[model samples]
Structure formats: structure tokens, C-alpha cells
Target: MTALTLAAAQTIAIAGDVPANIQRHLAFMQAAAEHGVQLLVFPELSLTGYEPTLAAGLAIAPQDALLAPLRDRARELRLTAVVGMPIRVAPQTGVLIGALVLGADGSLAVYTKQHLHPGEDAAFIAGQGGAALEYGDNRIALAVCADFSHASHPRQAAEAGANVYAAGVLISEGGYATDSALLQGYAAEHRLLVLMANHGGPSGGWACAGRSAIWAADGGLLAAAPGIGDVLVIARHDGGQWAGHVVVL
Candidate 1:
């Protein structure tokens, strides 16, 4: 079987700065490519630093040409990257938290948050969610922040035949313990590998809890960032064995 390498990009965002954040993302992409990573996922609203008030003005259509640079880089490196941003399906539609899949083959896919935190509804609408990503023999299901809070979300992914459940979130330090435990529990109960990508610093005024992580299907800790900053929590599966490591960026 072909080896599969996945990484959670633990990055700090420049609040409401798309240009700067894009540059940072490119840097992470380069680092991940150097580590032979095939799939990389970033934190929620990474491009805009979880700033809800700015989402409407910052939101872009999924096909907007503004993402050309990121798309070009993904194709060049043959790396599939899932990046977070605010999106509007139509000019008249409300904004939604989006996780955009930039495929190595130059394909684009969209996954939006199906659930929202209490106050989030004031700024965004609940999405219908997106499709699974297929790579080699592995099938990946994508979740955004609050989407995983709903028990039915991951359960649906398992029923859909997804072996890997990846979530991009902006978790605050206070909520980290509870959230991480739930993610780990899902890994055990659903027998699905779980990967979490969290913000490395403050965003939307919340002190983010970095420590991005990956868990084995049985809920064993595979790899995790010690604290936070610019790092990559990576997991590799080859020859029927799983290995993990951390790369400081």
C-alpha cells in the first residue's frame, strides 16, 4: 500500500490580514512539503483570525481568483491543503465558516461549518457541510470548529466510511481539555483516526490553545505539538505501521 502522510499546521494568524496570512500559509506548505507531507490542515478562519465581525467583508466565493497563489503552490508541491476562510455561496447569502480543500491535482472542494457556537449565529449561518476527501486507500472527513461539537457530526462521517476525521478549530485554553478529550473519545468510539489543527496564538480576542494533535484509531496519542507557535504535528502510515513526529517551523 502507498504510504500516507498527514500534518496539522499549527500556525498563528495575523488578525484580518489575508495577504500576510497567505504568505504564512505558503511558508507552512513549503515546510510540510519538505517533510513529505501529502495532506495538511490548518486552524479555523485561519485567513482572518476567527474575527466574526469582519467575516462579511472578508468573505469570498469559493471560486474567487484571490486564492490563485495558494492554489498554484498546492499544485506545484503536489500537496493537498485544507485552509480555513469565511465564505458566501452567493452574493445574497450569509457568510459561513469554510474549510477549503486545495487538491494537489489543482482541484477545489468546499466544507462549511454545520454547527455554530452560541454567539456565532449572529454573524454566520449554519452550513450543510461538504463531501469527503479520497486519497489512495484512505477516506477523510472534514469538520470545522463547532461542527465536531455535535455528536452526530463525527458519527455521520464514520457511517459514511471515513477512516480519518480531521477538524480545524480555534480552541481557547479554557476549552482545550474538554474539546481534546471529546476528539480523542471519538477516535476510540468510532475507530477513526482523528487529527486536530488549532490556532497557535490569540485570535478573535481568545487566547488560543495551540498544541495541535493527532490520535490513532484506538485513541492512542500519535503526535502533538508541545506548546504552540509555528509547528507541524505529523503522522505517517506505511508498511502497516503508524509513526509520528513534530516539525518546528
Candidate 2:
């Protein structure tokens, strides 16, 4: 079987600053690429912070120029990057919280959040269905912040034959305890390796709890971030078991 290396990156997002955030994303992408990572994931709303008020103004199209650098980088490194942002649903419509996957060969695929949190209804529209990005022997499913909270969200991915469940979130320190428990249960029940990319600092006025992490297929905690700064958590399956670790930037 072909081995896959996955990375979940946490960043301190500056609200409404697409250029700054994209630059920071590039830095993280570069670091992950250097680590020989094949798939890199970032936190929800990573390219435009978690500022719902500014989402419409900052919402980008799938082929926006702001993403060119990352595409070039992905192509250069022969990797896939799942970067988060608020995407314009359509002309004169609304925005959706989406993870846009940039492939090594300049292809793009998007996975929008199928579920929205209570307060998110005001500024975001819920997406439909689930998507799994295929690579090698892995089918990695994507999830946004509130999507992981709903049992049905990951179940759809599991039922679709996903072996990796990766999520991007903004979890407050107080909520981490509850959120991590859910992720653990997900790993155990689905029998899929779980990965999370959480914000490092304040975003949308919430104090983010970094704690980026990787869990084994059997629900074992493999590696976790220190709840601050820029951190990348990686996971890989060896012949016998899944091994994971963190790389601080």
C-alpha cells in the first residue's frame, strides 16, 4: 500500500486580512512540504479569519488570484493543500464556509461545511453532502468546526468509505474538553484516523485553543499541539500502526 503523510496546521489568524492570512498559509504550507507531507490541512476560515461580519467582503471565488501562490507552492512540492475560506456561493447570493483543496497538478476541489452552528446561520449558509479527497490508498474526508459536533456529519464520511477524518476548527479553551471527547469517540466508532487543525489565537472575538492533534484509528491520542502559536500535527500509518507527531513553526 502507498503510504500517506497528513498534516493539520494551526495559525493565528488576523481578521479580514486575506493577503496576510494567505502569506501565513504559504509559510505553513512550505514547512509542511519540507516535512514531506502529502496532504496539508488548515483551520476553518483560515484564509479570512473567523469574522462572519467580514465574510461577504472577503469571500473568494474558487479561482481567485489570492490563491495563486499556494497553488504554485502545491505544484512545486507535489502536494495537496486543503485551505479554508469563506466562498461566494454565487453572484448576488451568499457565502459558504469552505475548504478549497488545491492539488499538485493545479486542480481544485471544494468541501463546504454541511452543517452550521447555531449562530452561524446569520452569516453563513449550510452546505450539502460530504466530500472525500482521494489519494494513494486513502480517502480523506473533510469537516469544518461545527460539522464535527454533529454525529451525522462524520457518519456520512464513514459510510462513504473514508479512512481519514480531518477537521478544521476554532475551539475555545473551555470547549476543548468537550470537543476532544467527541473527536475521540468519532475515531473509535468510525475506525478511521482523525486529525484536527484549530486556531492558535483570538479570531472572531473568541479565544482560540490551538491543541491541533492526531488520533489513531483505534481512538488513541497520538500527538497534540501546545495550545499556542503555529503548530503542525502530522500522522502516518506504518505497517503495524499509525504514528503521529507535532512540528512547531
Candidate 3:
């Protein structure tokens, strides 16, 4: 569990197609394993391409077979993968936009989105708060889009002694600059290494700004996707310093 390398993935996701997206995720995970990444993160609602209109019907149950391939791949590669999907909050009630953490030991953990965007609440239920996953000495906190924008979100992570803050967002071109600045602020103020995973193609009918990136605890950019396609921005930590590179698949 002594994780040294982490990656943020930017990839094309098929809207409303869980099986196809899972296939895409498997390919991405394969590429990440070849690059020696201990953990790989995908953008929000990656499995369903942020299509809120189809969320309720496409909500993945905890024991669904669609998740089996991902679980098996994570176990085989011995690398953790944080993937996005819509999860049922309650039976026949509604769903919560969620990030599912697949551990190398074949374990699954979920973190639901605590904050929703302007009109997302109509389809997705808001969660209570953010959640963190642990790997050896590293405690990585999970945050969806608006959750990272809130000041109290990082504070909560700081209170929990988290060393990494990971986010999955579908940022448009116009919003990238502002969101990146805010994320950098979180990295500097909280001393948490920040990482973001975003879509490489259209999702939810929005043209996504594909710039999956990572920032050092000191707020310096470590790595970022060049343009689009299937890309990975990876950061490796050594003796308190981080070195990074971008991998194209």
C-alpha cells in the first residue's frame, strides 16, 4: 500500500452506455498499469458520461456484474482505480452521483457527491459530505465538482489529515481557468497534493475541457494532458518531491 505514483485520466466516454464505458475504463486501466501507476482516477460520472437524464435508470447496484470486470482488472493489475457512476441512494427513491474506489485487494468503496450544480439536484440526490480513501501513509480525499469549490470541503479533508485531494469534474473550456485556480489554492492552503480527472470528449451534451492534471503540495503544476484523446497525467513522489509526465494511449 505504499503508493508512490498516481494518475488522472482523460478519456472518451459513451453517453448512457455502462458496458461500453467499462470497456474503455479497462483499456485505460491497462495503460495505467503499464506505466506503473498505483492509482488511477476517472472523471465524474465516467461510466455514464454525465447524462443525468439517464441516471435513475442507469444507476449501478453495488453487486452489479457491470462492475465485475473493473474489479477483476484492479485486482489483476494490483492498482486502485476510482471510477464514476450513478448509485441508488435508496430503493425506488433516487440516485447519487458517485465515485467508486476499486482497491487492488478486490474491495469496493463509494463516495457520493455532496454538492450538486445549478440544476443537477433534479436528477441526483446530494450526499452528506465528502469521503476519503487510505493507502499506506497516504489518505486521499474524494471531491466532486462543486464540493471542491466550497471552502469547507478542503477544511474537512485537512481535519482528517488527508495528504491528497482528488477531484472528478466535467469542466467546460471557459470554466477551466477559474477551477484550476481554485484547485491550486486548495493545494497550497491545505498542503494537499491535488489531482483532477476530466472528460476528453463530449458528455451530457457539453464540450468538455480535457485537462486532467496534477499539482504539487506547494501549488506548482506537475503534469497535464496536452489536448485530448486518451491521456494520463502522472505524478511520482520521492523524498518529498514530485516528478511527473504525461502518457498518451
Q: Which candidate is the best by TM-score?
A: 1
Which ten-residue region of model 1 has the weakest summed lDDT?
1-10
RMSD versus native structure for model 1: 0.8
RMSD of 3: 1.4
> Which pairs clash inside model 3?
none
Q: What are the Cα lDDT values of the candidates? A: 0.95, 0.88, 0.88
TM-score of each: 0.99, 0.97, 0.96
lDDT (10s digit) by residue, model 2, range 169-203: 98998899999999989999998889999998999
How good is model 1 by TM-score? 0.99
Q: Model 3: how far is 123 from its true place, Å?
A: 0.6
Q: How accurate is candidate 2 locally (lDDT)?
A: 0.88
Strongest candidate by lDDT: 1
Cα miss at 233, model 3 (Å)?
0.8
